[model samples]
Target chain A: MPTEGHTGRKIIYDEDGKPCRSCNTLLDFKFATGRITSRAALPERAGRESRTIPAQELIPGSKSYAKVEPPDVVELGNSSWNLLHSITATYPSKPSEQKKAEMKQFLTIFSHIYPCSWCARDFEKFIEQNAPKVDSREDLGRWMCEAHNAVNEKLGKEKFDCNFWAKRWKDGWDEN
Target chain B: MPTEGHTGRKIIYDEDGKPCRSCNTLLDFKFATGRITSRAALPERAGRESRTIPAQELIPGSKSYAKVEPPDVVELGNSSWNLLHSITATYPSKPSEQKKAEMKQFLTIFSHIYPCSWCARDFEKFIEQNAPKVDSREDLGRWMCEAHNAVNEKLGKEKFDCNFWAKRWKDGWDEN
Candidate 1:
């Protein structure tokens, strides 16, 4: 059975017939996929009502629950955002032409090879709609912030103020 | 004034003559750089003994301490690793030639555009020494684990067992 991701794309399956982990959230791929039909598969949640376990916690499994747990889509997405924002935060304020070209190239390749197929496709479309402005740190920072806000909006999360991209990613706020 | 990063590279300065945030940890760039000379600059730490504050906590500045804080080298590096490892975890078990080439291109671009100059240089050198092995998921995962272990070893951190790359990055432990 195939699962449809948030993007409405049918998640691809591995040789084992498990849905691709990178294309779907752990919830859709793990619990909702009917793979854990046996109560024995979820020892921690066996005796407890499913509602008691936070969805996020249930997916990653607490450290005590698993010795080593692979990151789900959410975990991967958040960390990737951290890295991307940090990159823009430190971008040269006045980049050389070569630097600008390289930055654009980097983004293009990043969008192509991002682990999350659906997420990457969405981002590629986003880039097509709003081409990266890599002329300066400010341009890049605002562009990335806007990009993040788009995701946030799609996820029904609160959007960050684009005005404070620098304060959030580069300099500490004055109040500190 | 310029400060030296853990990599021993002289942290570059911006037009304002402040040390580069990406090249140095927040400790070296923020407190140790002498830029925060006045007591007012450290509103939270001013009244207390510096020893009471954890160094990592001090660099990130608690949300209560600062409205928004940029990531230092440590924060950026950790997040970047999370993204990198996740990429390898989801990489195809038997990839196409195009996938292999694209992955290599992504790594090269990532090395060039990584926010931390010193860290990027080190990674570039590492890549040259050990070219990426992207033929299969197993090969790529082990290669990435070894690469991360190299950095971990340099930082005096415990090394991960490369044999368990799938357990750590893709499949949740069976014990879970």
Candidate 2:
């Protein structure tokens, strides 16, 4: 559905056909709406002297606001990793034939359709090169760790020790 | 793999433990591991003394510091919905037979394996009652809106109007 602004008035396009000053890519559309609604919950300009702040400007590099709240790219990426690893941790050690097939299919499709488009595409290609191993959950988890490390390696991040799977995700860490 | 704590110490289980006092359910040991790690991230001693706060407690509602934050159910759910609706918006208006079947299968398996277990279970039942329609993108989008509304109704949230699909996700709102 077309999202509504706070007021009842309909949003409209710019008649001047000027490029958006802030982001000057090819004006994506020759004719388009100028009512720039935002998904980010930035504040609205209240008084005549007030100026609108672009979401990007209010971010880390802004120098105006450093300690912004949660759910940024890095945090979201980590959360997704935590979730996927937990799922792998819970994967059946000895899956049924149907379950194995389902898991394999699920991973293949997941790589294609993850929300991060470029990341999804890269993972799809990676999967093609290294097809998933679904024979057992151990194999799957190990492979997943390897897969994650590969992504980390590409991004210049440190690799994780795959051997710690049980400690981190399943069994409690061995304190002794 | 065992996870290590920040101190490089491992977390351990009690040698001869009774059920944990905090959580009183029967130790699901026959088919479980009393490894008993918690995901909640609540502080150990929320409101007792000279302040040492776990990151989890700084979150709102947390007693210690109340600012701990990660994507909770609400944020994750909304992000998931955004991804799903965007996917539907991009689905081929006139899909090939293969594409149609793939999309249908994708939705079917998605409901079964979504990360939120309870949400997945509820969606599985919902899909059984309302089989998906994938004849065209419009059909798919409408189906998604209806399915989302069903969930919203269950959660006592407002229903979205399906008529403005293009205006919202695809073509920014048409002001004229």
Interface RMSD of each: 11.9, 17.6
Best candidate according to lDDT: 1
Over A7-73, each residue of candidate 2 has an lDDT whose tens digit, in order, gives 3322222223332211111121111223334423223223311555566644333323222222322
Model 2 chain B poorest ten-residue lDDT run = B22-31
For candidate 1, give the docking quality class from DockQ: incorrect
What TM value does the first chain of each candidate achieve?
0.61, 0.57
Give the local distance difference test score of model 2. Answer: 0.53
Model 2: CA > 4 A from native:
A1-83, A114-118, A160-176, B1-76, B164-168, B171-176
Interface RMSD (Å) of candidate 2:
17.6
Runs in model 1 lying further than 4 Å from the true structure? A1-66, B1-66
Instruction: Specify the highest-DockQ model's number.
Output: 1
DockQ of 1: 0.18
